[model samples]
Target: MMTGGPEPDSPDVMSVLELLAVGAPPARFEELLRTARREEAPDSTLAELDQAVRLASRVQALIGHAQQREAGLAALVDTAHDLTLVHGMEALLHEIARRARRLLNFDMAYIGLRAADDEGRASSIRAAEGETTSLSVGLKTFEDSGLGSLVQRSGAPAWSPDYLADRDLPHSPDIDAVVRAEGLHAILAVPLGYGTTVFGTLYGADRKVRHFTPDEISLMRSLGRLAGVAIERARLLEATRAEVTELELDTSRARSSLNVQRRVEAAYIRLIDLVLSGCDPQTLAEAAVKELSGALVVRDCVGRTIVVTGTPPRLTEDDVLRWTYDAHAAGCPVPMPDGGWVAPVTAGGENLGAILLVPDEPLTDGFGVRLLQLTARAVALILLLQRTSTVAHDQIRDELLDELLSDIRTQPRQLIPRARRLGIAIDEPHVMVLARPEGGPEGRAAAWASSYAHRMSGLMRFRDGYVTLLVPSEDPLAAATAVSEELTPLVGHPVTVGAAGPVSGPGRVAQAHREALSCLEALTELGNLGCVATPQQMGFLGVLLSENRGVGEYIRSVIGPVVDYDTQRFTELTRTLDAYFASSSSPTRAASDLHVHPNTVSRRLERIAELLGADWQDPERALEIQLALRLHRTRRTLQHRHAATGAARDAGSPAPRGSGP
Candidate 1:
């Protein structure tokens, strides 16, 4: 691209060339050809290009002077720094070499960094252009590579005027080829040193035979000295970097240790609190999630659990734990005796849940067995924390509901808005259900309870021991019944059941909660195992029966006359009617809840309508009856508990004998 320089024939150009040749070595003449350039130009442009070329050479000649070299050295030394270290050593060195070669006009150059051991050296063929991409310039070893060996073995600069002709060393096939093809008339190699250690070498090549001028040799020496100092600086910078790396590693370890220590301390405190409070596993779990998730920097930690032994309570859409049950049997991470950690979280060998700890780095030491063992212990503790937390959550739920039951019936209206304002969550048309384990550990039972509470209301262990939930969209009776069925597997024992009919309103939410609790308590046996109700499941009837303290007791008083009307008859009748009615919506499943053939349900419906003087053929009356049963069930549940369990329950419990919440 350059069109100026001394011309072959001009007097002024010859004169400058002559001065340049005064001490130029005959060994370097051909090498100059590789660096020199010529281009066609108009007469005036040629003149200007020649002037520019000569001017640059003149200026560069002065760079051999003391001051410029020093500045260059400082720049070279400073470049080995910063987050750039992320690139590792080889890439960093190559960048430096490439810049130096292009800047200094060296035909080719390389940096061979020596190692502490005599044979331990790592060097880069740092820069080469007019070369193939796959081409490599230096041999890897200290012994085979000339620049590497010279930098390590020689105490001073080494010159190879005729590289192939140099009898003192051996050459590889690639180097031999480079010597012949490059017309490499000579090479001047210099050792870059730090104190007594030869850290690396710097070299320049000549493509033709010519003598090196005094200034040329001086420039080479100057460049070499700068490179030597720069290499030493780079090494010191690198060494300090290594030290910083060690410090950072230590700091990271300390930080992680602090975090783990904090978690352990928190766990211990929780265990103590659980014991003192006599809270079951569900309660403990709820408390742990509230405390631990807040204390640590974990996201959505508690719900990603799978309960194998105990049936879990109803979960809403957002409860991740509901999905985890699908995961445990698929990919287990807990370790087995076969020497890998792959076992999942299980309570008493029953897969209760799987715990996940997502760390910025893999939780691996990548070191000795002792560190690995410590890692295992840490993981074990984490799993223990998750499992214990689940149990604690469930136990707290019933106790929580029991505590708040009184408030629900008193203020039946403040439900939805209260829930939203308190950061308590609710899904509309939601139903609430209650259950307690028959003969399981209080902790596990409670954990299941809290889990469902969270699932049903999207509320997790809020305030004292309460769990609010959001139920899915389905018929209220069907959904509540399904929830009860879903819970049996989680609690791992026979459980009672109660459910609220679907209704919307802040005030009415309390009514729903009470309904659920009452149903569960009153129907503790198989008579109401699958969302069925004895007279206990129905609303208050006579004045005498209605005057009773509890619906179950009231139901018992009226049920003596209907003793022969056992759970079976009720189950069959309800099943038939549900099937016949829901058949319009393809309610075969609803019929299943009633335990009857779909066709038989049709006939039962006709007979019932005939007896009640209502027309089964009339959709309106049929729907009314269904709604009434649902409401009856809902009312039964509410009579036993306060309606204010929903968010709006803040005012106070309503007086007794007010129409059911």
Candidate 2:
């Protein structure tokens, strides 16, 4: 195998020594030695050259070993730097495997992390580099066999040259198969960790049978220790980051809570200021709406609107009432249509009203709802105060009305002042209206009367089972008629009203009241239920029913013969006489008025004269006949009107077509 170096016969000891000292090829040294021996130089010279060549060869080998160690140490320094910079455990493991294969000149290098479960324990290859087949990353091995287990258990480096033949350690058939498949003949591994806590092992293997030097094993151990420290450092950093994140979340929550409190405080201050300013319910509601940037409607207990602010959601009265009921029951704000909300305005357990709010946008949280509740409470207080004031005023007015209607006559001096205080001018002309509830509950009639009287600025009270109002008016009958029409629908039944007086002062009130009562009685007696009447409108019937009863004498004298004729014949000769007189005694006009021919009228009149005396045609008697006929017709018309009303009443309907006398 040695060629082109030196001839074997030539003696060249100095030259070969020079070549050996300068690190020439082994072939060159071998050729120089062969030439020195063939030259047959002196035995001492041959021996000296041989010793010199051997010494030079030994020195060269030492220098080469030193340089390799130096290079390995430099690579270890670079690995330490790389490990310190690596951020994750897996990346550091891969880098360690790569550096190990490069430094040791192994066919394959890999790291195996120890994994233990309740069922069993094993080492799984986590990272690998170089030419690997069966011993790839994620390969697992049990502790019974494999170099990983030996290194982990002993906490030391392990190596086996000619791994298939080594029998000092237990070998698993499966592990051997993997090693053979990987074409590995030698293996070296070092425990990766500090002290006795070996997390895993780093492995390096060669395809050819070769011994692993101690320096290489030690270098790998150093790298494994550095990898373990790096992994622990990464874990600590990750835990610190988690803690920082949680702290930030808590801080954000605290800030949000503080902000909410501040806003609530500000809103409370604004509400208190509004209340102290004596603002009306509407004004206060508007302020609240402005603050919340929403619309609101406030309603009273009876579902009447008290105030409305902004353009609240469109809802019917029934919708508002339903929402109010639900909110009151729940004692909280409830959602409504169009992104609105409703809250009951309650005070001292009384649901005074409700407030409906329609926001410009939907609420994102409970704060807006809570704000609405606060506003509702403010509105409730305002409503309660208003109601209390109204009740006190009504009490005063009711007391005054009671005194005015009292039967005991009070001096004008004593009454006028009291009347003026209640906004009534007792000295002015006022009519006394006596109203009787017809086929209806008296209590509701009285309540409605009181309310109506208040609206008219008059006085009302229940007296002698009648709801009476003394209102300012010149036409008592017209006022009575107006009251009847107005009260019919409200009471859900008919009401008969009888009015008397343009009574001038408080002194004449009792007399006027008696007149109204008598008129009311006359209406009932005449079958005129649900009718309005005054003494003047009742004509002669009114005159007959008056306190002065002398008009009966005049009636009997003027129409006695006709009355007797009617009683005898059971005919309406008296009605014919009355129509004749009403038509100015013209036979033709009288026939037309009675819806008959002139012959019938003339014959009736002749019969009436025959029943009395022929002298009834004289002017003195004729004048008397005319007056009596007029009175009789008045009575007959009233009787017919009464009959019609009675028929209607019997039918269980409203008053007949004609309303008043």
Candidate 3:
């Protein structure tokens, strides 16, 4: 051997150089060192060989550490990619645990999340992966010595190389029991979440005793950070998704409500148009039926059907009455027996009538019901307009009649033209009727008369607390009777109607009115309540009660046939009638007074029966005939006396009283 240094070509030196250059196993270099030592090499050579063996071991160890760092870096890159790809919190946490176990090369790995409200005071294992027993998952602890709490407090990684045997870190018995049961020897806990604020801990554990390298710890901490970011991303995505769902629901609801509002508005516009066009209740009901898809029945206040649209459900009068009452009480629509609704048509706090609706399908919401209510209001509006028109027309009629009957002198000049305009024929024959209610409401009789006059094409006037009418009728009795019959039930009491002449001309109205007033007064004086009568129907009292005081007409009405027969036949029937009355209806006595046979008197009586009715012998007829005969005889006697007086005056005057002779 050379003294200065081992020869460049030395076997041991060459073998070690070759092994270092080729990157061979340290075991091969060790085998060469042991063979040199056994062969008794020189001291210098042995020292050099020993140095070579030491150098080879350090270089190999450095190379192994570098390879481990490279592997950990590759795993970290993969873990970052996977953590970024994972979506939900739970799945991301599970993936993080799995990556942590594989990255750190641990027996098991898990993630522990702190209670949100505990502020790092408590934590529970949320996810686990690798060869973990069931005891590892869902493990929770509140102890300050637990690794999760330690990592949270320190805001850094906490590790135990041998959990059961380590004394450097605080220990919790509960956590220790889980460690023992799972046979976990080494455990490393790293903080997860943003810097300095750990919401949870990422854990890597092993069943075998092992010390954690800085690279492993660093890799695990990186993975925890990536997991924390991914978890937050997933939570935000979930929140965003929830917000979007809620917004979609709100949008849908708003759209539906808008659609309903549009429909309701359309219906309102159509109905308002109908109302403005002066449509009748029937037309309004038809529109409402179309809108509501139902049948409609409109009634009057008295429950008479004014109009019916669609096929309405049958309802009796009693049912309508009862439903109307209930609807009025409720001030809204009431359910009917046929699964329909009755809405009271009210205006100005008055129940005008009701609109009954029979729907084809039961209502699911207030939309249909609301339309029904709207229809009811529309119908009420139409009815109110019609009634207003009617009332106005009636007022006009009343005013015309009042002006006509007020001053008869000016009636033909001004009122006749106006009457013609109103379709009232004042020139035609019309009976004047005056009436008074016997124990009834004060104003109802006037209302009844107004309405009746309108219906009968007549004129009505309420003056001085009496209802007066001028109706076109030939029969005064019939007109008076009609007034009584119509006005009684309306006023809920008896009505006394007194009628007079069926006046033919305009100026005669006042005279007829006076005669009717006198007849009314007569009937009242005679206690004829609720009785209808004309002056002619009152018999002889009619002439006395009449304003014209028709005496000659009354006499003619009673015995005109007899007087005409005596004049036309040139007979003594008047003398025989006077004798008969003087003999107290004894024809034989009368015949004896006339110096004739009773048989001749009987023939004259038969002729009188033929001229007068067969009932001439009746008590009432006899009385009327007797009164007429007396009046007739008195008038004839006065005429004879006046004639004698005229002749006496002529005789008493000087025949030659003429100054000219």
Candidate 4:
């Protein structure tokens, strides 16, 4: 066989060549000797054999090196080209695995890519010539094994000199079996990085024990750089495609918005369903949640009977109180979930509950106001629909009014629920309201209400001709006189307002509301009031509570004990004991405020303490009684205030001061 070596026919030259077999520069010696023999000095044949053998030996070494280099270069170039041509990350990975196998001259090699979720996966593998492999394994997450973790964490370069001895690789009988099967003796894995961002890893292995050469490492690093470039190109292309997709999506959304308006008129149908179909609170909440959540990310959405401060699962009613947009707000997030946000609202400003959408991710540079407007409008529409529906219309109206007081017009007990939701302690002065616009239908009234509602973000109604003004004024007479004289000229029409004294919470709303309404009816003419009437004077609560004993029961369930206990622990007997003390006890103001004879007041005080327990002697308990007494007086005053207002409106007067604070 001709193995690219010299012929061995010459006689004496063979002896020389044989002698030179293990010497350095043997080819040069052979050439020198052959030149000498060509002169035919008589030893030419001997020299020829020596020269030919040396040349053959030199040629063999050169050919062997060239072959190894050729193999390595061809494998690397092919891998790069293949990876570049692959459609996706996985295909590139597979090609990498194949190349690693070929260039490593090893039995097994694996290629793993970085996962999006802070993980790495050995997703591709290849077996070298003469190596056996399992039929199943092609791709798997690194979380499946410690070896993968070690490779990923050690990001620089790693070597498992003896795969079996690698503690980090995990102990597996199967691993050893696989290693043996694949004929892997040593392994090296190097990280693939794009600039500073690590993308994945490249690995090489050999069947026989071998040192991973610096040259091999160098080549792999070059491949890594190539990988980075290719990946970046792919990423750029992907980004461009995503931008195009988003543009299309935005256009589709715009079209859908127009289409959505067509279905908006079907709100009446939804109202019917809500009323007749009996959607429970959970269902209603779920519906609201789904719409809000899917369309835009919101912090929370809640429809409430009482929009109070400390509430949860509800964005504050305060946000809706005076909002004027569509009377509502709704819109999807702008930019993207992570990048930016936007929202739009519908309902009229009169409808006061607000939707608050918040992105799960950080928003773009600036979009706070947009989010607010969008949420307000969207929530307003949804709530307005809930409110104006024939089903539970009165109840919805009452609740909406309560929520509206969160800030627009004035605070009321109806708003107490919201305060509670918002975690604010319930202790604000409040009043009842009653409104009747004599000359207008509901639509006209609503339009009129809008002007005022917008003025204060009235949370109750997303409409107009709304009654929103300070009620339960400390100076009810002064207020009446002022409103009569001032507002009459402005409205150019008569308006009478019934006022209730200070009150708070839904517990007392009805009581104050009925009286106010009565007072309003008593005034046949709307001659001077800025507002028709407030709930305090309407005094609807006492009657409503009498009919709905459950209302009292509910209140008792929530906070009755404190009121009852404090009343007894603090009030009765102390009144009688006060006379016994005989001290003047700040009598001048007390008498003036009480409008009672000092002697009579003194006698009543004496009677109070006698009934109280001996502990009543304690000054603290006296103060407690004083407080309870004040509370009772306040309630009665509220009840009585409506009549006082009626007297004022009857006389067609107003308070002297300007209503604007």
Candidate 5:
């Protein structure tokens, strides 16, 4: 309906535009227009004001619609995270349908499962929500061309604006009758299944004729996919429960004997208590040792002894391996070469380790053997829990490292929170250690590195034949030595380690890696493959081998603090060091050379120690410090001579003879 009014000019339109900008309501706008009319304002002004109000109203409606959709999407995300805690299939399906209806504001939503034999041709509604009539539930359809059937066949969403009036797609008479009776229209059906296996369809319908937006259709499809995954998980959980129940029944029947039953019951009770108390491998081994009449020994999968009690016969690697194979094959305790019994610690057919029970005498009784086997199972469980925890922790650490190392552009501030979650204070001074085991399997070394890093509350990454760890230690050389010492025996071979940095922040991790690599390369070049060293320990050779040729950095790293202190206070520590070194370690001679008392030279040396470290005079550190002092003095002398020559030349005088090119 058009209202007669004069055409709008620029001035009248601008006034109405200002009203619209403030979001003035139509009522206020109408009042303004009425006042304008009373004031004998032009018809164009009234018309323009009316138009602005309409525009503002439409914008508000659109904004409100957008916010509602955003809230619905957020709810969908929450539902996905919540689905993991659901247990029953029926309850989960019902929840899925209800959420879909609520999120999409549908009149009704239902889930339909296709018949197993008919293959998308026949389906019956399994769950429904927001249904006005009970007929929607228990509803069955057999038509091949129905909405649900089509969605099931194609594994895509199908919709019709008017359910009964749409002729492009065929519909079953019974289904149409229910829809007509319910006055339903604007129906949508999306297939629910994982990947290529289409098992069912989810349908959303509205009573009034409406067009579902693309987002609404996509939301329904996402719900369908999530439902499919949830269904799969539920089915797997049920299967696992059934298997556990059956295994328990079989175990009970196997332990039917009175003595065996008593032992089994007591052992199982103790095992549960051990697990609930968060017992470690050593504790579990100790419990087994207490039960045994003689001695017990536990070793990890790699033949590393975890716990030993009493005077158990020493077993060589071959002995352990052979006995382990026999015990695993026999599925119980087997006799050891020393007349003892050994049981394989295993979980889900994976070998975790072995437990050896060396009783005082040979026991032919089944009870002793069964007890040994139970002990092994407990050990397996403990080890499995430890392995799982270590794996999860390592995964998080590796993720952080991946972000740091792979992407050099990643900000350290962004990774601080993730590092803190793993108990790594990334801002604290830390050293980077790079280790390469000279022998043993790389995988074993990597596993050990991961476990070691976790135990030390550090992060590690195994890449390109090297295991890199970022440990919170200020002394890189000591850290490297410790890693090599600890890993060498465990790996059954030499492990070369190189280290760099007491870097204060994680941002310099990449730089530390490069420096550490240079140390490693320098060691390898000198045939020092089974040793530990830092770039500072490598001396001037480190600068030559390093890619960055960090000679100035190396010199500064050793003597920069001393030089800075001397510059700030105008001290003679640098001269004292050179004189002390030149006088063949004689403080009297250095004092005589400096023409000062020996006591003054001693005080300067002590200050030098304070500036450097207490270990500044250690053989290795002293060598580095002496090298830094010589290089620092030489560079200074060259600078002074060059400056003198430049000044002489600038004064129109001949340069000094030795300084000439």
Candidate 6:
């Protein structure tokens, strides 16, 4: 504000000095030079002014460069912070691209991650920013692209002033087209990582031709390094999570296996306990069914049900048959329609039986199948044990029965006590039944008879090649008939049985046995195979065939003369007598029965009377004669049958030496 002559510090000069101190732009300093010339300043003053302007210009340039560097530093710091906050790779890459453009002031900036395919020959742009054109975020660069290829191959930062004209790196026509379309001339690219394991490339481009400075290239490399660290960290974290999940799954499976094994062990212990306790087959099966919460059925070798337990599904005979076949064939537990299982029970490689288990719920693992198999094994053992015990009991009973049927030397008092010990009530009214199997082995018939006798609470033995059973019954004939019917299927053929007495005491057993034997023989001689009979069933034939009957004395007392006449003259007087008695003594009926004339019948009867005496026509004598005739006829018939049997044997026998081949 000083006036008059110019002051030591003029306003214009002070303004210029202030601009120089503050390091203003070169243009401001140039204005100061113009002011100094227009005021016609001294040469030394002008020179000082020019020197100050020059110095200020240099200072201004340095300050601008420092400020730009500080701004770039701040942008880099922000990028690092943002990267830390980024969780996703795509987001992190996009943020890097955005920061790069803002810090470098580029026309376009993008990040490309290498494809994971073989050779990593291509890079796909994952993120982009500051694009004037419609920028495709995922633009891909080929193997021949100049910027991406040079950066990846060199594993360092790379750039080109004019990418289209560059010949130092491979050039791609498609990349060039995209670059031209985007109006991009200058490009800088840096590998995302070091060495051969580079993950991707980072790019910055300008629309105008430009020479990328070393500092700018270094900045791009820093961004690339930061992106690489993030990508690697994300991959490691994902891998760790996967490994942890797999470990947890393995631990869970191990625990499930342990639990199943524990349950199976407990089931096995329970089965052993049952066996040790001497529980019967039925009891063991019931326990298994209850523990398994299912239905259980145990069958014998013959397909007969030994034990059935629990609320099982209704099974038909056809279903049982099918299951048996399947179980036997598979030799393991077979799954059924109702979430059940079937297994064969075997011992000594013999199919002892079959077991069916139908659970309330489906078995999820092998534990249920294992349990069923163990149960079947237990059942097999029980069945085998029972069979052994049965054989032992049969042996003991057979011994006692033999002694009881022997000679009277073994007193009834001693026999009774032994029979009592064997669970037989010998003092009770009992019948002696003798069973003869037709066309069946004696051993098989004896064993079957013993089993049958045991079931009926009787005593049985194989004596003199005959299966004899001493049964407690009031009616011997009825008992014999019952046994015959039961033995039909067991023997697999016809069986003839003879029974005697409802004898009151053990002392009468011997007599009863003899009578039963006699009845059996009479049945054979009478051609009544497969028939059951008692001594009383033989009628008058019973007396003739009785063990105590005096056959010759009886015939002599009745038709003695006729028998003597036939013996001496070798005539058929006995046969004529038999015919007369069979026809009720009517001459005409007798002739018809003999196939002769009535007069011939009459003459034969006259001859019979002359030999037997005239009183033979009386009722008492006639009854005797009739009885005697039946005895003679039975004897004759038996002799004829014996002769025929001998003839048959001779016929059936092979011819001695000259037999035909």
> What's the TM-score of every candidate structure?
0.28, 0.35, 0.48, 0.30, 0.46, 0.38
> What lDDT score goes with residue 553 in model 1?
46
Against the true structure, candidate 1 has what lDDT? 0.45
For all predictions, the C-alpha RMSD in Å is 33.7, 51.6, 50.9, 34.6, 15.2, 49.5
Worst 10 residues of 5 by lDDT: 1-10
- Across 105-218, the per-residue lDDT of candidate 5 in tens digits comes to 898888987666765567888888877777877888775667987786666799998989998887778899789877898899898874346778888889899898876886
lDDT of 5 at 388: 34
Pairs in steric clash, model 2: none
Model 3 steric clash pairs: none
Candidate 2: 10-residue stretch with minimal lDDT: 384-393
lDDT of each: 0.45, 0.72, 0.75, 0.45, 0.75, 0.72
Consecutive 10-residue window with the lowest summed lDDT within model 1: 292-301
lDDT per residue for candidate 4 within 1-661, as digits (tens), equals: 4222344343355544544453434444455466556655465555465556666676666666658755665655555555555545555556566666666665666655655565444433322223466531544444455344455565466677777666766644544666667667787767765433466666666766777765576556555545554554455334434534554465467764543332332332343245334444334433433322332332212232422122233334334332312233333322322232233332211223333334333533223333234333334333333332221222223344544433333335435565444333334554444454434234333333343332332222322343433333444445544445533332335545554535444455455545555556555443434454433222223223232333334333322443455476784233332333334356544555566676766555455434454454467655544444444445556656666666666789862233221
lDDT by residue (tens digit), candidate 6, 1-661:
3222322233254665677565555566676677678888888888877776676677677677758755765666566556655555667677778878877889899888887774688888888887766644667786666678777776768889988877776777777777888889899898885212577888899999999886577567766766665555444334434534553565467886766656665775677578656689888887787667777888765456879887677788667768776897788789887677889885434566689888877877777787788788778655544443343344446556756777645346867776788778888899999988886545446546655677778888764556788989989889998888776654457898998888766777877888898899988988998998886666556565455446766776667877888889998777777777777777888788878888987788889778778888998677767777777778877777666666666899643443223
Better candidate number, 1 or 2, judged by TM-score: 2
Worst 10-residue lDDT window for candidate 4 reads 300-309
Which residue runs of candidate 1 sit more than 4 Å off their true CA positions? Answer: 1-352, 355-418, 421-427, 455-457, 460-474, 525-661
| Candidate 5 clashing pairs, residues 3+ apart or interchain | none
Worst 10 residues of 3 by lDDT: 1-10
Q: How does model 6 fare in lDDT?
A: 0.72
